[model samples]
Target: MRRMIVLGLGALLFVFPFYYMFIGSLQAEPDTTVTSVLPDPGNLTLGNYAEINEKVNLGTSLLNSGIFTGGVIACTVVFGVLAGYALARLRFRGRGAVFGIVLLVQVVPFQLLLIPLYVLIVRGYGLADSHLGVILPFAINTTAVFVFRQFFLQLPNELFDAAHVDGAGELRVMWSVALPLVRPALLTVVLLTFIGPWNEFLWPFLITKQADMQPLAVSLANYISNVAGRAANPYGALLAGACVLAAPVIGLFIAFQRHFVSTDIGTGVKG
Candidate 1:
């Protein structure tokens, strides 16, 4: 009974926001107001969704997010794995220093780096307000490299040795042996990288001033601004927009939930 109650409460807490958003979205924009905490059920309508959809190019924002997220994941996987393997396996000068710097980089707050990065993108490279401008800096993730290195360090020497004996080169060994062995870590990196871009607000908001180039989070902010003094019906529509904006992330988590939830457990058990 205790477990049941806890589970029910947890489920309710998890579901409540989406439920409220849905309820808000269903009501007419005119009915959603500061005067009422809840929209009138009798006046529930999908018109808000239509209004929001008509105003914002949600499809473009979705595409931009997909591209940025995909690019970040691709860069992190390729570069992170290579750098991780080097740090884990290679014996060379400055290796420890490099790893130490990576640790230090992880400690540095992203907010601090924002100004320099923006200047570099806008003034230095002239990539201002471009998609590449926003994504390029985020491509190289220190934490991802660190995580991959830790997992790579735990790998036995015999695997590499066996591959080497079979005439496999470093690239071949990494491609065939190392990658397959660290599926959990790779998945974790991909998920984190994707999430960073998917829910990113500040960087996207700052970098992409143009409406069409903005990601969903930034677009949503502009959306709120547009509906600020509008009728209550627009509030319902705004809520609907919020739901649509959030759906992809929620769906992604739901789709890959098992992998994400079990990764830590699996790693702990294996260790």
Candidate 2:
């Protein structure tokens, strides 16, 4: 009974914000009398979404978001696995030092690099407001490296030994053996990378000033400005956009489902 109560409470807490946001988006923009976020059932309207589409290029923003997220996931998966495997299985001079440095780098916040990275993007690479500009810097994620490494370390040694006996090179082994064995970790990495790119606002806002180049988050903000400025009933449309922004993530979670919480062998260990 206590567990059921706890779970019900937890579910409510988790769901309430979205419910409120949806409700608020459905409401007529609060007039002098209707100050509350909750909308009167009769006053529900789709004006907010219409106003947003008419004013802002939301479709373009979503496309940019998709491009950015797809690139991030690709880079994170490929690079993360390679770096992780090297740290776990390979031996070379400065190996320990390199691993230490990599782990240390992970401790640094991404926000700290924003200014310097932005300067580099703007001036050094001449890639101002370009998709590659944002994608390249974030491609090398230290945390992903560490995560991959931890997972790789947990891999059984017998598999590597058998592959070596069969004259399989490291690359071949990775492609044929290691990758298949670590699907869970790969999925985790892909999901994380995807989320970071999809939901990121500040960096995209700073780098991509053009409305077309802006992501969903930035575009959504732009939508808010247009709707509120005109005194339109933005309830349904804003909620619809929010749902659009959230859909991929929510779908991803649903597809991954039990995997999100269930511990698989690939991520069974932590460094």
Candidate 3:
């Protein structure tokens, strides 16, 4: 009906820019005086993709990004789960204070912490020009901890009691009983945390001046800012770099979107 048509138009508007960018990346460099949103089929070429690799080592940048983002994801998953489970289930002094502090961390802008992180990770720790240094500042995500804690809080207390009565240790209880039930939170936090370190340019650029150590974002940024306009097909080359930078994240979400459905809490508890 009319509503369906409206929704279709909205979707088209949302998708048009991406489609435009992809097509533009396949195009030959256009003359500055010429104006057309669509590229001619005859003018389409893969030369732009080849051009981007020359300006930045795409292979090395991807490897660097994988190492950085993967490390952060692993560390976040392990630490977020531990802290969240403790906050939700354990009896301890200063639990409220700890949770409050975690919440307070989310309120502070990352920019405010940038200076201290630079000094500590770069100068104090002497980890400059290293993958560990790039990964250090983002190892634990406070927002992820809060998310895991909330998800743990939502599960039935009976589940924990049953595990405890069975003489399960705390780690055993978490891994076997509680962790299985929070798959949605894991996916969400992974995706959310992925975006931060994946698209991160400033921190990585600041951490290392070496070209081989830079992530895709930093290299692409350097390309777009300094070298793109000098290319024979500047616009196409720029968009091609963007496509490379965005492809993995978009593919990940598409692959994992099916698992992002709501969790059925009642199913986790046994009679």
Candidate 4:
């Protein structure tokens, strides 16, 4: 009973922020005090959402976010899977060296490369003010590659050998035999990749200043910095913008949470 109480309290602790954000967004009047945690139902209103929408075109911003995030996720998955499969299943010279370099790259913080990346992407490549500019830098995620490699390594080698003996090519083996068994990894990489690009404001802000091209993160940042203070209900308006930004990520996680179970890859291999 004590353990159940503890777990329930922990769950409530994690859920409270989201609950408060939702309630605060609905508040007609700005409320920051603890008393506002449980505001009167009569004080609730949708005007905060309307106000933010008027200030920023939510649809356009959301669409831009989708395009940028979608492109990144697509590239990350494709490249990550191929690179991972090669590292795990294929014999090649300098494979260990290459994996070591991937690990090395992870140690370097992305912020350190910001200046050079901005110069090359914007000035050298002339991709400024374009969606490709924003998506290009984040296209090949090393972390996703590492995750895929680890998952692929967990699978039994017998599966690959069996597929090869059946006259299936490398691509065919990966597509037919290997890919189906790594559903959990695929979903994990997708969710991880989604969060980075979806909430990324700095890179997108650097890539494009065009209002229509700006993603929701950039718009929300600008709104909070410049316009939210001017709103009649600044607290509610800020929370409303946050709600809009967080909803998709929360929904995706909830939908896919049950599918993160580990696959019994060894079942295919006989003792």
Q: For this target, which candidate reaches the highest TM-score against the unseen true structure?
A: 3
lDDT for each of the candidates? 0.77, 0.74, 0.83, 0.85
| Candidates by TM-score, descending order | 3, 4, 1, 2
- Whichever of 1 and 2 has more lDDT, that candidate is 1
The deviation in Å at residue 100 for candidate 1 is 0.9
How much is the lDDT of residue 89 in candidate 2? 88
Ten-residue stretch with the least lDDT total in model 3: 262-271
Candidate 1 lDDT (Cα, 0 to 1)? 0.77
lDDT of 3 by residue, 1-271 (tens): 9999999999999988887878888888553344546667788889988889888989998999999999988998899999999999888999999999987876777778889989998899988889999988788888778779989999999999999999999989999999999997887777767877897788898997888989899888888888877788888888898999988877876887774444422111110
lDDT of 2 by residue, 1-271 (tens): 9999999999999998777766666655543253454557786766656655656666887789998888877887788789899999898788899899996875677668889988888788887678987677666777778888988899999999999999999889988988888888887777656667788777777677778788888778766766545544555566667877887888887887665544332222211
Error of 2 at 40 (Å): 6.2
- Cα distance off (Å), candidate 1, residue 78: 1.4
Per-model TM-score, in order, reads 0.86, 0.84, 0.87, 0.86
Model 4 residue runs over 4 Å out of place are: 1-14, 258-271
Residue 9, model 3: Cα distance from true site in angstroms: 5.6
Give model 2's TM-score versus the native structure.
0.84
Residue-level error in angstroms, candidate 4, position 103: 1.5
User: 135, model 1: CA deviation in Å?
Assistant: 0.6
lDDT of 3 at 194: 80
Candidate 1, residues 1-271: lDDT per residue as tens digits? 9999999999999997787887777875454455445657677777877777777777887787888778878887888999998899877899999989887776677678889988888889988678898788778787778778988999999999999999998888888998899998888777666777777777878889888888778887887886546644667767877898788778878988776654333221101
